[model samples]
Target: MADLTGKRIVVGMTGGVAAYKTAELVRRMMDEGATVDVVMTEAATKFITPVTMQALSGRPVFVDPWDPRVPNNMAHIDLSRGADAILVVPASTNFMARVAHGFADDLLATLCVARACPLLMVPAMNREMWGNPATQRNAAQLRADGIVLLGPVDGDQACGEVGSGRMMEPHDVLQELIAFFQPKPLQGVRVLITAGPTAEPIDPVRVLTNVSSGKMGYAIARAAREAGADVTLVSGPTALATPRGVLRIDAHSARDMMSAVMGETPRADVFIAVAAVADWRVAEASAQKIKKTAGEPPTLSFVQNPDILATVAALPGGPYCVGFAAETEHLDQHATEKRQRKGIPLLVGNLAQDALGADDTTLILYDDQGRHPLPRQSKLAAARELIAQVARRLPAGRVPTLAARPAPGSPSAVPSAPPSPLSLP
Candidate 1:
């Protein structure tokens, strides 16, 4: 199903070149199953015709407060009545100032004042204009009034000067909209996640790595961020963009991943180890590329890599740890045993052949209470469900502070046998 299914959105367009982008936003919202009602200001009509927005929304665009099409002649009141949210795209400085002080002179501004739903504004203007003290104060006032400002992210502006005040792209706006509706169960929580396949060097140009694409881990990071968690991702090599609002650290080898995880674990409320780390690494990797042999292949020695999950789980009063097991056979037996061996509160299991590098797969959560299978679905969906489960298991009150826990590499932080399993909800 689409993310915004059955959502009703009222899109308000103010005067700006970014109105072209809003056309795409309206179409994309509908594609995601949201019915959009476009409301344009007189200045907005000057930039982009109401006909264009009307064609995209498949409804008459409202410009005048007294739009005769509305049976009650109160377009502002009727348009925003049942809206899930009212988004003012490319909200001009004039419009923002007007709304900031409760001046409902225009149709869109009037609707905003009358609407009961949440209000989101996307600012788009020249860098100098956005940097102006007056504009800043207005922005602050709007925020203080419970208005959500999506972004006027720093980038090239239409006036050609590069700085702040660029409107977020249409696709990004759509993502923010989707996230705004998600439950913030992980709010104020710090999450540390490891993803992708760690590469262990055998030579300068040769390394051993698994087939993990990091899709599932990245999805979980996105889902967790959407749920309002402060997320940090320790990622192995992958060709994927960092999820918006996530701090990503790159880890190439198993040891690299272990070090990164250790450094971040002290601050985390929850730790999810999902990377397909190589179990072993070359004991004495060649300084240069290994030369190809004509008669026989070169023999290489191997040493076991440090177990990241077990190490974190062994930390006294550490973050709640969750592990992932991808098995080719005997999933239940292997997954349950691994969870116990690692001493983590939760373990997610799936068939390696079915899940690695795939867009969708079935996930089974193993905890103190036997197996709980989740329906096969997209990685993002599974990630959201997993995050929900993790949220439920978290203990009440704030996570332990840094002062309350030993530093990761200190002598007192040495690994011990896993303590009794964490109590699950």
Candidate 2:
């Protein structure tokens, strides 16, 4: 099933150049199985025609407050009555001021005022307008009134100037909408995760690394963030973009990963060791590039790397540890033994062939209760399920202190001091 299956959304557009993005948003929403109803203000219609929105939404666009389409002529009330949420895309500074004061002079504002569902606003305007003292006050008032604001992120704007007050990209907006509907089981929890494959340098010109693509770990990071955890990812080299609302630390080798993980683990409530760390490294890596010989290869000795999970688990009063075991065979035995060996409460296991570099895989959760296998599914879906399992297993009465946790984009939300930068071979 699609993520938003059976969900009903009301997409409200105000006057702004960002209205073009709303067209894509509506199409993407429908692609995710959400039934969308497009609502437009008079100013919005001037920017993007109602016919364009109607074509994208597959429903008759509503722009007039007194349209005869509604049986009772109350489009504002009827349109939003059954909606799960009303999302105002490209909400202009003027519209925000009107809504902030409860003015319902227009159809979209009237629907917002009459809506029973949650209201989410995406502010899009000039940096100066957004930074205006009055606009700031209005924003604060809207927040106080329980309206959710997605973003007016810093970036290039349409007015040939660059600063804050740009609408979030359509994909990002969709992600936020999806997260809004998710269960915040990890609210106020601090999660530390390691992802990708740790590289061991054989020489300046060569490195040994597994085929692990870090998809699962990144997915878990995103899921944890969506579940309201303050997530920090210690990632090895990977081309994937950092998940929204996640702090990322770069790690190249096993030692680099270990250092990063240890530094952040003290403040973490949960530590998920998901990186495919190399067990061994070159005993003595050559300072210069090793040249290829005519017949024989240069001999190299290896030494075992520090066991990151075991070390962290061994720490006194350390975070709750979770380990992953990618086994070529006998996953049940290897996974169970690994969990016991590491002294962690939970272990996730999967077949190496099924999981490495793959987007979908079967996962088995091994705990004191026994092994519970999750159906093969997308990494994100599996990650969400794993987070749910972890939530259930957490100590009772571990109530979320959401207010105490740093809010996203706040200075405190970032790592105060990052680990030393890794110099990759």
- Model 1 weakest 10-residue run by lDDT: 416-425
TM agreement with the true structure for every prediction: 0.93, 0.93
Q: Candidate 1 lDDT, tens digit per residue, 270-374?
A: 999999999999999999988888979999999999999999999998998999999999999999999999998899999999999899989999999999999
Instruction: Report RMSD (Å) for each prediction in the order shown.
Output: 8.0, 5.9
Computed on alpha carbons, the lDDT of every model, listed in order, comes to 0.88, 0.88
* Angstrom error at residue 324, model 2: 0.5
Instruction: Give me the displacement of residue 363 in model 1, in angstroms.
Output: 0.2
Clash pairs for candidate 2: none
Which regions of candidate 2 fall more than 4 Å away from where they truly are? 397-425
Residue 96 of candidate 2: its Cα lDDT?
91
